[model samples]
Target chain A: MSAKIMGFDAYNFNFFWLMLLTAIEVGVVAQSENMAWATLIFVLVSIGVVKFIGIAAVFMHLRFSPDSNVLTATALFPVIFIVLLVLMVGLTSPSAVENLPAFCRPGYYGL
Target chain B: MSDDHGYHHGPHEWSHGAPHNSWAPIIISIGSGVFLFFFAKAFTMNEGMNGYIYDSAPLPLAIAGLAIIFAGLISWWKQDFSFDGSYEPQATHGSTPFSNVDIRKVGMWVFLMSEMMIFSSLFATYIRYRTSIDSCYSLEGTVVEPGTACWLPASYFIAKGGEHAHSTLGFMPDALVPGAINTFALIISSYTIVMALKTAKRTDLEHAERSIKVRNYLGATFCLATLFLVMKMIEWFIGFHIGPFEAPSLLSDQFTIHNDAYTYNYGHGAEAGAMTVDIRMAASIFYLTTGTHGVHVFAGIVGLGYMVVKAHKGGYGPGNSVSIEYFGLYWHFVDLAWVAVFPAFYLY
Candidate 1:
């Protein structure tokens, strides 16, 4: 059962999808500006997903090991990193102090 | 305790780490750090002063560092050395806890993961800068003559030019077409590497020969990559010579190399460097990002060169193709980065 499961072939997986996305991104960037924006975001998200799968599936050899704990650790690490980065950038990127309109400039605000 | 049950030994264990008196790796590390630090400092410092001394240090340090690394590799490769009194291989504390396949593959993957981030940060920057400028340009009307009645504020000029400004309206014609061709070359190389891995997995000598054939194809791919690097360098030199910033093309008048302030088009009879703002931010960033990636490609080529040397010595096969696979992953990642970079930097 383990042998069978280990060698089981799924339909096109992450690497395949990644290459496809690359081509699609090239096409989108070339033709449509709107599509280009979507493609850019999509590619970044796709890269994160594909890297997660590669690190977990191949590097950890979970297909052979069947360790549930290993799977959890591998997936959790990336999620935590991403979430932390997002939280950091979200809070800091929009600076109320710097971004205020001219009328509300610091001197006039009497702070 | 039963003889075997109380303490089971494994092939992966080795007992050499703490007792060993090897000073090579530490020395090499320090030497490399010093060399890179000096090299970077040289770039930031004035070219006239202390340049001679700083430039001289790196080459000798690099050679000595390589010598130490080579000595370590040779020592590691030797079969006679062992922690146990017996010459025969033993299960001890320092033995690598990985099959060669696993260790090398993991190493490669780890390497590629870092590389992916490097490329990602660059692409992300390009996207942010491009979107900001695009929105600004559309919001404000067509860029017009500065200091005229209709001229925008110095702050406005400074903000546009101060932020991510572009050095050129579009990429020079030569750079883009060559870049596209190289993209195709990289894709083809990825295909060839897959074939090499497939051939290595076969159980026959003919398959081994086929593996060599595939490796040769891989080498060809490297050659193509090298050619692409050469073409890119040539393109950069030509751009420098032509001065992309000083002149203007049909699309927009606001681009230059040193700074990206709004400049009047040369065709529109504006003087060289005439502008309320310098708008070369986009182009400079574009060059720096792509140029750094190009350096990575060059490093990958060196790795491939080493792999080719080992391949000739019969060091790789189905059991040992992890290095090849990892490098292939890196090569493709780079190509994919360029795929985004070319369009984002050039087309938009």
Candidate 2:
């Protein structure tokens, strides 16, 4: 199905924005000295997220098709696992085992 | 079950009543098991032993397993090649969420979910190391002794143009050229794949013209995918010199996985010369993430090669265009991955 976004061809619209975001991503890094890195990082991450959504929604047909909702749900099913992994990573990420939270440490429960 | 259940079978169509009939899956499993077993036997390394143990005896067996795997892959490809979307199996009408949807489409989404988990773990590993390790630069002039392990992001060599830095382009570093090109290549390739899918579904064009257009678009995608890998190699190993400008590859700049003793200059003054630091962690993550993506790109090139030939033979048309859509999902996912990787590993 042919899709449109703001009166522009959906694919073309997404492509245009992806390119612009990428240019800005590079430009932001290139001019890192002129701006706070935190601001630059925020901009980079914002652009990345937008480009990602645009590609997934329009190009990958995660938004337009009839089964889009179900398929998108299928695609996102692993997100829970991903979130769990991230949380787990935070616990064990430090170099020392002793640095881990008490519950994560062995013999903490006094088996 | 009916004979036309639309499940892929072996060399020829199978008898309907005879279930679990395909030999491809069994053969592939055996081949993979044998390959891994022999390959592991071929190169054994033990920490408590005398270095690496090399045995050429298992090498032949490993090659044989590879040959068997190739045979099974051919069988699988043949089964798919026979499909033309005429009999696309859809879920039966029911109360289920996926009822009436193309089964293959649902299957593809399920497959993408697994892929998402794989990349997610990679990202997790990257994040953990990044948050834990102190940056080598941040350790400069500190009490933290030289040769201490630290994270030195790839962007140092890339976006920032480390040590012997140069910039031919006014916008970005010379070292960042390959990465920048790769980003654009992936984006363009993503668009081309979409165009291929769009053109495949076109009813207006003449059959021959449409076939040629689909083939060309697929060919373009294949070329771009190949170009991304080539640029990756250029960035990783073969530094480039373009007339008045020169950019050292990560290897040439000593930003390598084996770089346990990398020199990090504190500043310009004579007293603040440099300190040796271990940056293997950052390099490892960089290679693992980008290399994983590179492997995906390479796999896409192979798939696109087949698609190009198939489209040239008029294997795709308005009726069979779902083939392009399935592959398009994969290609777009690859681009989506780079959307995260480029900024995280290259720009940041």
Candidate 3:
């Protein structure tokens, strides 16, 4: 008989699926060179999902735990930190000057 | 398995609370922090690439930190706390073992938290580049202006020919394909580790002894991690093929320093000059972030070897397999981080 869902080793199972999804997302990103930025964003979010699943199901040990608050903080804090950090970095960086005629040539703009 | 004194307070007794309370880790942390501070100052100060003069302090500080941490661990070894740190029954009675797990796991979680921040910063930098052809196009949402001077320094250097002029708009290096292959390798390793964990949890000890599956899993993870590093080195070598094409642009510090643009407005029969592809910033940061992760993978390889040795020594099983499981968690964490990193930095 299959193991009971309630008693299933959710840590291992979720990690397995998360890794598989991560592999698939990597393939998608690899092959989607011609895809739109919006579609790329979608792929990124999928990657983010896999990341969350790994963190939630394993590192925080949420699958076996009874407390959701601990899990929520554990999972949410890194994300909040990432968002805040990205925002801070974005705000501090000088906006790229798009008006220069030399901007688009490969080696003209430092980027 | 959840016995409070046995699992939690056991290691505390092993070290007798004496060795574990040393100031070594704090000193090590501070030393490294100070080194990083000075290192940043060295860069901002523009200390003229004199590495022998400037890098001396940071290197020593890092070495001192390593020495301190290693000494502390060495001193703490083979003591009462060596066996089971949490459950020191005779001394510190009624101190629940749950308290130990709480702190220990929380610390690991926090360390991983810092790791996330580090990688994210790199990813954010990459996103800025992937979205824009140039700084102007990046901000103003306007189409890239045509006929900018293309610097082909790298091509000139590598091709051993007179400067060939071409447009820079459509230049791309083929780094993504091998990177993608490495990505798959890590994924496969993660699966193998999970399989190992599964085998460890099974009831048959004799079968587990004979199977050698966990050993194989750990070995595979090590191989894949090494493969990723090798491929990354190859990618850097490929960047060298473009000569000055890999140099950063002179226009900005945030971007790669590509050669200075010299405009030539020859009318009618003028062909567009060859614009070099500057892969320096992209390739450098790519290596830094991913390379650091690769070092961590190497460390994990060592950790896995330790785990395998201990497993052979019969230190882990279904009843007391938390150590192996924690290692598994860390391995998977590394894999998950790469899933985002690969696309964000390379494919996108």
Native contacts matched by each model: 0.01, 0.69, 0.16
Docking class of 1: incorrect
lDDT of 3 by residue, B253-310 (tens): 2222322232322223444332223334444455566667776787677567655665
Provide DockQ values for all models, in the order shown: 0.12, 0.45, 0.19
Among these predicted structures, which one has the highest lDDT?
2
* TM-scores, chain A, per candidate: 0.42, 0.79, 0.56
* Model 2: residue B250 alpha-carbon error in angstroms: 1.2
CAPRI docking class of candidate 3: incorrect
CA-only RMSD, every prediction? 10.0, 5.9, 9.1
Q: Ten consecutive residues with minimal summed lDDT in candidate 2 chain B? A: B10-19
Candidate 1 Cα outliers beyond 4 Å, as residue runs: A1-76, A86-91, A95-111, B1-32, B45-101, B116-136, B139-175, B239-257, B260-276, B332-348
Output the lDDT of residue B8, model 1: 36
State the lDDT of candidate 2 residue by residue for B1-348, as single tens digits: 223554532223444222124477678779989987999899875553224678899999999998898788677667666556645556766737887677667767887888888899999898788877887777777766766889889998998888767888776778888888899999999899999999989999999999999999999999999999999998999986767668988989988876777888767676586778888889989999999999889878878988898888888898878889988998999999999999999988
DockQ pick, better of 2 and 3:
2
Which residue window of length 10 is worst by lDDT in model 3 chain B? B153-162
TM-score of 1: 0.57
- Whole-model lDDT per candidate: 0.47, 0.82, 0.51
